[model samples]
Target: MGRQSIKFKRLTPFFNRQRLEQQFSFQLTATPKAIDKRFIYSGQVTERQIHKRYGVIVSESSETDDYVLDDSFLIWQGQQGLVIITGCSHSGIDAIIRHAKKITGNDKIQAIVGGLHLRCASLAALKERKSNRSPC
Candidate 1:
């Protein structure tokens, strides 16, 4: 057998419009499988000096639940209310949204996108979401 060279494709940075607002992404990837979900709505932190400045909260899921914090973030467009985004939400997306609203007091949801991850939950899975109001 001869040795082989491994070639990998180069990745590119995603394109995003430049904005002066706080943004972040949180991902939890290991846990036990018994604990139920939880929401941590820590309000809009627009302060530029210290580092706890962010505009959303997410459920800190436990290992026993067989669940993890997928990908969750807060979307804020200046004067608009907070619109939370989720990725493959094993943690309740509804819980995230409610926490964000309660924290920011911004009732109008601008939009919601990405995977629902319910596998076939239909109504019971995503009734708390803002629904198909996407301009996409």
Candidate 2:
């Protein structure tokens, strides 16, 4: 017999509101856009735009350096490749794309949406400046 594993947890209206709110602080809010695409879907779930509203913090490397565990959305496109959506790409967009390609084994990228936190040279320097730099 072949065993199948479910990869994701579906959030539905019938879910336990109190438990979810206690654990994850669920809030009723507005929706900017919605798409129905099987198990994968896209939506503008937050009003905050441009720079990330939170989670971005300064690393010990520099006082001005910003870092974030960027959240990404992936959708496989048949012939065009994968569509990537990001929320403040602190790891660099190119890096993200490369990683996606490597994981999905697809070279084509159909589309990219959301914020790309590109900084000026000065900002980049400040951000990259760390007390203990490690060689890769």
Candidate 3:
């Protein structure tokens, strides 16, 4: 599947949450705009093997999409190589790695730390993944 575009209208509720919280006497800072493009990894990945069943509801109207385009991975460049920090990796680990490489223009991944989201994967799939591994 191709990358999907998210409309700004769908994000209005999230951006306006601070106003909603004010009614409850809770203080919250205004939501900041997204990071600049240069700091973000905007390319698509080759494989989206997992989290295919996941859906994202981006608006109050409950519109949903099968893919989570907002998912991200934190990459740190070090003297040794790149360290990737992720949360759940809803986009798939392989995809995250590929995107990280594309963004940094570096293929040397030093370490990967965080959730792989493989709990629901079948044993056969796990075995296949293990068998396909190559030394880094």
Candidate 4:
């Protein structure tokens, strides 16, 4: 058997900005809340510098040497407890959990689903994580 090379082309390259904007409507608020306050945004996150990454680009020339501050998680109040759903957790899992607890005033966490992004963590980093008790 022989290997074969394949090439792909993008069909849709441009978007209809005006039409899309007219079709969809959105509301932007400092405190994003939904579903009768059962679900809410974690807002700005303050993370520990243990696993921080730098050199993130905000614009063409501007960059940040700190972990992402805009990273957020979705907190859903379930029947049993609150479920924290995150995407990458770039801000830090501990910070997200703490924010969720603080905003909702609920310390009971039923489950945490989605990316923790700890695949490339070192042994010492994992040990440090273990030493710090989870807020959940």
Candidate 5:
């Protein structure tokens, strides 16, 4: 298989709701933006680096340290590269897969599981067949 991408759940209507949480309505001809001004997508996280929740690192584009993670892989022994799981990826599943490959230094995706979050995904299934090329 080539690579896989899928979404696990549907986001609330207010998922994309943008509110002025902070006060930064200053003048800006060409000023830099902060992370809070963006929508962070924590794709289908499956691990728990801490001791609470099983993470589902979603991919996102931000100026902050890291609002989202492109890699949802779990390092078992070496590297499995099982699937590129994500949920409602605002940054796009394609972009997320690309980042995973780059970060893992591998082009093989085992499987994909999660929501693509495409405008038309509501009327379709995002499950895809991999090309049988897993990271070595």
Candidate 6:
């Protein structure tokens, strides 16, 4: 066997404005990585119905359930029901599901994908994981 040189291809940023508009009108974007702030993209995807749903809330909670108010979600409506895609679900899954069904008028949850933050799992459940029945 002989050693060989590998060649790599340079990739360029490609954009077709017409094609993109046909699919999804660009929604609000938050580029900042800070937990305390959010910034929207300054592109021309001006649809009033979309932009009204996004922003930041600065209030804090006295309860232990307090979490970031910037937790947003993406809901897709299909023939069966709504498919919810969320980040850390700080507002709770039940609340999110309820809101989705109310907004879309679909009670059936076709699918839910993302972290549901089960920080309150019971001690027995945790112990079960230590047993052979459940692997780490």
- Candidate closest to the true structure, highest lDDT: 4
Per-candidate Cα lDDT values, in order, are 0.42, 0.48, 0.64, 0.70, 0.41, 0.50
7-100: candidate 1 lDDT, tens digit per residue: 4444643433233223644433232121222323233222211222122333345212222333344445334544455554434555555545
- The best candidate by TM-score is 4
> What residue runs in model 2 are displaced by over 4 Å at the alpha carbon?
1-66, 118-136
Error of 4 at 132 (Å): 4.0
Error of 3 at 124 (Å): 4.9
Ten-residue stretch with the least lDDT total in model 3: 26-35
Sort all candidates by TM-score, best to worst: 4, 3, 6, 2, 1, 5
lDDT of 6 by residue, 1-136 (tens): 3333334443643445666778877544532121222221112212221222232333344222223444566676666666777676666566666656555556777777787655697878656534622211
- Model 3, residue 1: distance off in Å is 21
Once fitted onto the true fold, the runs of candidate 4 whose alpha carbons sit more than 4 angstroms away are 1-20, 46-54, 58-66, 122-135
lDDT, ranked from best to worst: 4, 3, 6, 2, 1, 5
lDDT of 2 by residue, 1-136 (tens): 3333333455676567776777685433232122343113322222122343333244446333223433444444456557777766655555666655555566776776677644454766645632212211
Better of 4 and 6 by lDDT: 4
Tens-place lDDT per residue, model 4, 1-136, is 3333333454765545666678787554445466465787666655443355543445456545555656777888988889999998876777777777888888888888899877898989988876674545
TM-score of each: 0.37, 0.39, 0.57, 0.66, 0.32, 0.42
10 residues in a row with least lDDT, candidate 6? 40-49
Residue 92 CA displacement from its true place in model 1, Å: 0.9
Q: Per-residue lDDT for 11 in model 1?
A: 64
- Return model 2's CA RMSD, one decimal: 16.8
What's model 3's overall lDDT? 0.64
lDDT of 5 at 1: 39
Total colliding residue pairs, candidate 6 = 0
Give the runs in model 3 whose Cα sits over 4 Å from its true position: 1-16, 19-51, 56-58, 120-124, 131-133
Candidate 3: residue pairs that collide:
none
Clashes, model 4 = 0
